[model samples]
Target chain A: MRLSKKGAAKPDPKEGADRTKDVLGGTEIRIAYKMGYVLNFYREPSFRKIEMELGITRPEIVTLIFLNFREGVTASEICEFSGHLKANISRGIIALEKKKLLRRDVDKNDNRRQRLYLTPAGRALYAKYIPALRERERAMLSCLSASERKLFEGLLDKLAEHVPHWTALDEL
Target chain B: MRLSKKGAAKPDPKEGADRTKDVLGGTEIRIAYKMGYVLNFYREPSFRKIEMELGITRPEIVTLIFLNFREGVTASEICEFSGHLKANISRGIIALEKKKLLRRDVDKNDNRRQRLYLTPAGRALYAKYIPALRERERAMLSCLSASERKLFEGLLDKLAEHVPHWTALDEL
Candidate 1:
């Protein structure tokens, strides 16, 4: 019921404001509000950068990511693993095939199903992007102490686990 | 350079199977990506709830939040603080005035400048929503240990402050 003084939640902005985040000077902070606000800021450039530089869109990369992690999966498996739209996954499969990053092979058991794999090229692309992706992650988390980072990441999973689904958010 | 075993990052899916969050039971994880994804899930319900039950749109509620945090600020200031568009701020301001949630008064020293404040009704509305909001936040973050929750909230601010602006994300 009490609104704390502004900026009481964290250290001085002068210390942390190196460049990426648009942190308001005054902060009557709410956990969910601030987190969602920040996610909006961070999402655009990463998604756009991957597209602009690699000529690969999010669904494409996401499909590749699933393939990289778990090969021998079919398009529907990718859909189940990633929850991407069926159409988007189909389009992504086609785009990745065109890029030669992935190859779609017909299932011997069922000709109707196409098993997907990260081609050597696609695997290379994933490896190449790892550094950049890791760096971005590092920068986003650089503010946390080593101990804080561990706890924060651990808690993130816990909170994420707490929600059975998005609809659960409305009830909460 | 290392991709850990599956489910190393987030909890196992069986633990948090929900309709909204498409929590991947995989090895790769990124702070910003996962957060943004969850935010997208949480955002729809809260926003839709406000709109359906209270008739306040997202932009309108967001504007009120900023005003609630930092009163006496101009519309342009809210835009700068939240990175919201000037047009959206103007529209929100008009909506709030119509709803009697806020009042605008011209600055005496600068006749051309108008300052905004929450009316008594607005403050009451804010108070009314506080419990529901706190409840939602608690549920979203309930998985954390008490100590972890403390560090998590603190780190959220630190990381948020890390970005001076969204463009800095491109550099990262």
Candidate 2:
């Protein structure tokens, strides 16, 4: 595991002093790090109540959210849309089906594929759980004024739409 | 599995039209969804090469990044800083130790606690892999102008610092 340190500089005292402060502040990775930090707040705590009350995992909640938005989508589509692993989504779909919250139908146009839809139970579960998500989001964004929120949303839209341009590591 | 349709309104044609569009554009969950969308690009592809070259998982790379920033920290500290699970951070620490890239020292003040530091090999590995991360971040943020980037950063800082207020499920 050792690599040649031929060109590696000695750790400077000044740099060490700077490193002792925060995680990513004033660092090259701050942007991504900060974004991830905020996302973490959304990931675990935001969904904790739903996960406990409904006996569903984060992946299952994600599946419900996606199906709530668009019915008759395949697992791969959910994976693509949610950025979740195919295996996780597959497992969630199976669990939701077993829980009687979701159902699958053979795609009429593609016999090899199955499309997912929420059962009435699933829809009701989503309805019951969505307000919490909305409230959490509202609280998270409460720090911003209405105009600042609009500006932030626009910036986010720009970055989200730009994902394809920079997502490939090989391209970098 | 069927839910009572007592108060459930009929699915409107306009709402279905909106649903057929892109994921999370005009929805209540758009902020979180957009942030996650941008984050997925960073989470998977940004670290793909490093993962391949170093034979380290995402959690392990995250471990290295955190250690690089501040050494002599515990796994729990890393979890708090990185928003990763303790089990994953513990696993990464074990793997890094096995690879001889990291070492732990028992705290003199508290023998039950251990502090982690990067080995020379680990430092070299971090040095080599960090440029790619910097470049990826640069590319990701290149879309924004300098002023807009500043604004976005401020918003992120506000949200990240506000995490404590909204992070608890019970608070919501």
Which residue runs of candidate 1 sit more than 4 Å off their true CA positions? A1-29, A48-133, A165-172, B1-29, B80-83, B98-100, B106-114, B124-130, B165-172
Candidate 2: give its CA RMSD in angstroms.
Answer: 10.4
lDDT of each: 0.64, 0.74
Worst 10 residues of 1 chain A by lDDT: A1-10
Cα deviation at B57, candidate 2, in Å, is 3.0
Can you give the lDDT of residue B57 in candidate 2?
85
lDDT by residue (A22-92, candidate 1, tens digit) is 33433444667668655555555566678888888778877877777678778765554454557888998
B48-145: candidate 2 lDDT, tens digit per residue: 77888878988889888878867887876677557777788889999999999999998887786688999999988889889988888888898899
Candidate 1 has an interface RMSD (Å) of: 6.9
Q: Judging by TM-score against the true structure, name the best candidate.
A: 2
Give me the runs in candidate 2 sitting further than 4 Å from their true place: A1-21, A168-172, B1-21, B168-172
How does candidate 2 score on lDDT? 0.74
Number of backbone-clashing residue pairs for each candidate, in the order shown: 10, 0
